[model samples]
Target: MAALTVLALAVVAFFAYQANAAPDRPGAGGKPDPTPVEEIVPDKPSETDGADDENPALPPDSGDGVRVVYSLSAQRLWLVAEAPDGLGEEVLHTYPAHRSTVDPEPGAYQVTRRDEAIPGSDGVPIQHVVVFHSDDEGIVFGFSAAVDGSLPDPSAQARTGGIRQSPEDSPQLWEFAEVGTPVIVVP
Candidate 1:
């Protein structure tokens, strides 16, 4: 009886080991799966030809002597002028600009005059004048005069003034200056 019990225990252990162990090779059922490995590498830079060299110049509506062109769509003001070679145009200046909220206006704005001195400095003021319009969309154009010194301190006292509009326009024009409308820069 003791021998029979020992033999039974050995048989159970062998089956348990076989069930838990992984097979070295695939059985007749299916092929074994391959082990997966991962690798990482940095990106490489690529060379490119100068495609921008062939780009066309700004439209004629910008003006023949247009030293600068400001596009509301691109939100960028670019200065276009004749290059030194006198063949193609060159970019003289590029600046980010805040567009006007008024709709349906067109044209390239210009700085015509300055109204008063700047807040703090005894420098020149800002004034704008409309020179050209790209479309009859009713968009106005103008420029603010350049400041000579640093900007005024905001915490100081505020100046009070009122703006008046002509009888031919609506109340909106009176409240705020529309886009393309020139502003007189004051020192």
Candidate 2:
């Protein structure tokens, strides 16, 4: 009995030491030590970029908040985030992309999975895959970039749901679209 009691006390003491050794963080039963986050102000869009009705600031109806807005018609994608000040949202990056073979119907979806590198449906090496949706036919839809920086062949009869982005741009999208992050598809 004494041996068992000593063992129980040792276990409790070890946990107490671990708890004291843990780093202090905000909302972790410690005083909030808020860290200031410096916001990166991406170059503001040119006034004329949306001066024409052809391209009005962001898609006409992309919902506000931290989300990835994909426009099927414009063949563009925008990574948006809540401003550091919480005043509103900011478009961290935007770039042109090739449309996926199977479009997730115009609606809201969330990033479901991701792959750092894999062979795309077209048998080409792709990286930074950020998958968000899948169609009824079991085709998975996601954003990726060809390692060789090649865009999908417009004439290829391949049936793939991979939206190809520029090699320079795919990494940014992959970093921004984490699992459960909202993805808004706008027509």
Candidate 3:
């Protein structure tokens, strides 16, 4: 009886910690933080709708709402979310990545699974894996960061589905892309 009580308390504490650690998003399984985020307005607005050469804009065709956008051709990904005030969308972060040989067709998908750490198809230790799609051939497509800070060498191994990001960027992507979160891929 005492063991059961202690286990119940431990479970409650774990949930409480997770709720606080979760991102403050509508679909991220946590209550949105009531604090308003400060928006940094540029002194000189860009010529277009907030997009500039330095910070590439998301493809106009990408559907709205909070989503992780992946561009196959550019080998880049962006984490976008609705502005706190509900005015417009904001790009929280973007970074370049190394993709594997097999690519998922351009479209929308959702994060189906996540692993804190795992061995990638290339046998490299990886972390913060957020899997969104899998091909009919049994290849699982996901975003992850190599534990050793090295990208996959296409010529060194068989086709893999791990899209490798920098160690710094993987955690942010993992936090933003909870299961059921949308992932949009564009050409």
Candidate 4:
């Protein structure tokens, strides 16, 4: 019992040390730090280049310069990466996508989870799943593609929260999006 108590205290002390010892941040005293506001640098641009401009949605709508955009009204998705110099955004991929019969609200969401293959709520085999939103009823709004490239045809009574993509698009989405990646939905 004494050993267990010591171990617990050690764990608490480690956490407390971490909380108090952030390397680059201003100390608790809030003194002026060495790194000035003007000297701060923006994030470096992504390395990938734009995909073929032949896509109909070549010029994707800017969700305020965010990387990924899902248009509920158009049923389309655009995958963008920042240009190497931060001068602009490059359209990495754009394709026709399908949304749930009940669309999610227009807003920004982050990729909360991913799965390589899983049976959807409607019992369809899906792949490249990246979930971003969910409703109170446990219905999730996510991107997936039917493994066989079949367009989603949920029964009329089936209220699915799946936003499906083409089989071709699924792999790309899986590779690009990870946990915390921004997924902006627009009406």
Number of the predicted model whose lDDT against the real structure is largest: 3
Residue-level error in angstroms, candidate 3, position 20: 22
Q: How many backbone clashes does candidate 3 have?
A: 0
Flag regions of model 2 displaced more than 4 Å. 1-41, 47-56
Against the true structure, candidate 1 has what lDDT? 0.35
Sorted on TM-score, best first, the list reads 3, 2, 4, 1
Those runs of model 3 whose alpha carbons end farther than 4 Å from true positions after fitting are 1-49
lDDT of 3: 0.82
Predicted structure 2: lDDT: 0.80
For residues 1-187, could you state the per-residue lDDT of candidate 3 as single tens digits? Answer: 9999999999999999888676763446543332222332222326777666556777778888989999998898888888778998878777788988778899999999999999999988999899999998889999999999999885665877889999877877877788999999999
Error of 4 at 6 (Å): 80
| Alpha-carbon runs more than 4 Å astray in model 4 | 1-61
* Deviation in Å, model 1, residue 54 alpha carbon: 19
TM-score of model number 1: 0.32
Q: What is the lDDT for 41 in model 2? A: 41
lDDT of 1 by residue, 156-185 (tens): 343211111111211112122233333222
Location of the lowest summed lDDT over 10 successive residues in candidate 1:
34-43
Q: Number of clashing pairs, model 2?
A: 0
How accurate locally is residue 20 in candidate 2, as Cα lDDT from 0 to 100? 69
Sorted on lDDT, highest at the top, how do the candidates line up? 3, 2, 4, 1
**Root mean square deviation (Cα) for candidate 3:** 11.2
RMSD of model 2 against the true structure: 12.3
Residue-level lDDT for 10 in candidate 3: 100
